[model samples]
Target chain A: MKNLIKNFFAVEEVSAHCDGPCGVYDPADARIKAEAVLSMTKKILAMAAPDPSDAAAVVAYNNTMSRYIAIKEDQAHGTKTDILVLWTDFFKPQHLEATPDLHDKIWKATKLCSACKTTVSLESAEALMAAVEDIHNIFWAAKGRDVAYYTAS
Target chain B: MQKYPENAGFFEYVLLLLGRRKRIRVTGASMLPGLKDGDELFVDPYAYVATHPEEGDIVLAWHPREADLKIIKRVSMVLDNGCWLVGDNPAESTDSSQYGIFAFKRIVGKVTSRS
Candidate 1:
């Protein structure tokens, strides 16, 4: 009976899973996609004015916007993934202890990121960028670096 | 120095190495300028274990049929059903548009470092 109790209470070694923090986050991935979204918006607006007879331009504009929409969806997914990684792997218990607002900022950014997928608008894309910038701010703050300026359009 | 006759072997060493989340070097240009063709990269399997892959992050995934060939690409979009991935160099890459979004399980790890 004692042996059984000992077996039940055995201390097994817990394996470490994450490769300690290696700076890998890139905002360009999201920036380029957002720029594409903004450009598509401009194209759509330009094509809307002085209606072109070549229907091709309109079709092209529509296709470009569609692609941009797809890209936005992709960017949103990336943002969520990055946020999750930081929240789960990078932001240790020490981070929470250091910055109490970290959790709230991450949650807000994630929520805004999901919203980017549900709609197709420059404003929505901008909102997504804003959220990412917020995350970047928090990330830099956690790392004790001067918050890198991210100008999102 | 006293010799320990029954020490851990090579296979044990390899097992230990694989046991931890290790980074591997990406050797193809399929990912291009952003993650130069041949760059050392670290991966964190546990980081995105619970969450799904997102856009912009590079991921190492298995070839759906082959399983042996590991492909690396930037995530373009993630749907409830699958994830859309693309190579940085569109000119010479076969990606989500060609094969459709892939099942999430195929992803091995997220690239965490590059040098």
Candidate 2:
């Protein structure tokens, strides 16, 4: 059955492990998600703790906090996904040689992404941004692009 | 003694009948610039039976990871341990480096001719 299917597909070789070489790579994806995580973290921290005696104030506070947390978690995961795809599909051995710390940088950045998801600390979110910036610089350098780094602040 | 020129066709037919020669359609881009996808290849199953495969020879072998998967790759080097197969298009191919050495027993044939 396998041989029959192999013959049916008859594709001599897979050019790439993923979708071949589509030449579509953008660090901007990671950047956008990382930015969102940072923004949500800031928003959550800035939001006031609702008055314990006021029922309506407490409900509003709970709703805002939940919404911000949800966005932060979603965007943190998105950043991880974006970075993983680039690491696996776009970046190659040559890129590694060019940027010796590429693996370590990505590892730290992904861990920070997870940290942001787990906690609502501004420090964790800022660290995530810094790690993403490192990745962004390396990505553009690999591509020979001269994109400048800018922050939401 | 008679010259075998007149029996050339007969000899080839016998080889085919005996499963010494085979025809398989090439399917991948690993050997691009030399062989294209969908190209038909005439394989000499006996090419490496008596002698070792030489470097640059395109061969059909079972994939190292998947025994049932037949892969066509070029012999990059004849190693003391095993033959090292590499694809013509290195950027696009996942060769011995990714899958490990291909055993001689796994090699089915040497691609003698292609169209």
Candidate 3:
């Protein structure tokens, strides 16, 4: 029977699947998320301090600032996740031969992510963006692809 | 079109000695874009009996991590100690990168043709 024949030859071929951890990775993922964090920080800083005399104005300002902080927090974490995935999955041990400081760079970049989420400073957010750009350049270079630098306007 | 062994062992050797290749059904995606899961191929065990596997050849070898496990991977590089076996789809494969080099004796056969 066809079923019997199929079962007879069904040899389990063990595949690495790259362990299902590696695939095409793009640094643009971290860039966009870091951008969100920066944009949120800027918006929060630009919001006028609510009128102290008006309870509603104070509440409105508080609500808006909290929302911006929440977005920044989420996106900052997302940036960290994107960077870590590319670092762990895409980059191989051989990549370190090309970019000798890649490990230190990733370490500092991830730490920047935490700083952005913990603080409302635009400076830290911009620093996170810079770190992500560094990673992006390294990633593209490893792939022999040319990509333009990401900037915040 | 003859009945093959349920467990590929002595019967495969018997068939090879008879000048016929053994058929094996691929069950993984490590060789993606070339070989797929469920694709059938004729393995020429005698192909390397008098020789050695060259780079870029797809080979069936015992998993270095486990003795009973068998894996299908490409010979990326032949090192002084052993061969560096890697899967075409590294993202899902656990090859030389994870388990180190594969010993020459572990290689079972060479995948000659696919159907």
Per-residue lDDT tens digits for candidate 3, residues B1-115, read 2112133445454544465565667775566656777776667767677777888888888876566777788888987767898877665577888889888888888876652
TM-scores vs. true structure, each candidate: 0.41, 0.53, 0.58
| All candidates: interface RMSD | 16.1, 8.1, 5.6
lDDT of each: 0.59, 0.74, 0.77
CA error at residue A8 for candidate 3, angstroms: 29
Better of 2 and 3 by lDDT: 3
Model 3 local distance difference test score: 0.77
lDDT of 3 by residue, A33-122 (tens): 999999999998899996799999999899999899999999999999999998887787778999999999999999999999998888
- Estimate, for each residue in A87-127, the C-alpha lDDT of model 1 and write its tens digit: 76456556777778888877876776676656556676566
> TM-score for model 2?
0.53
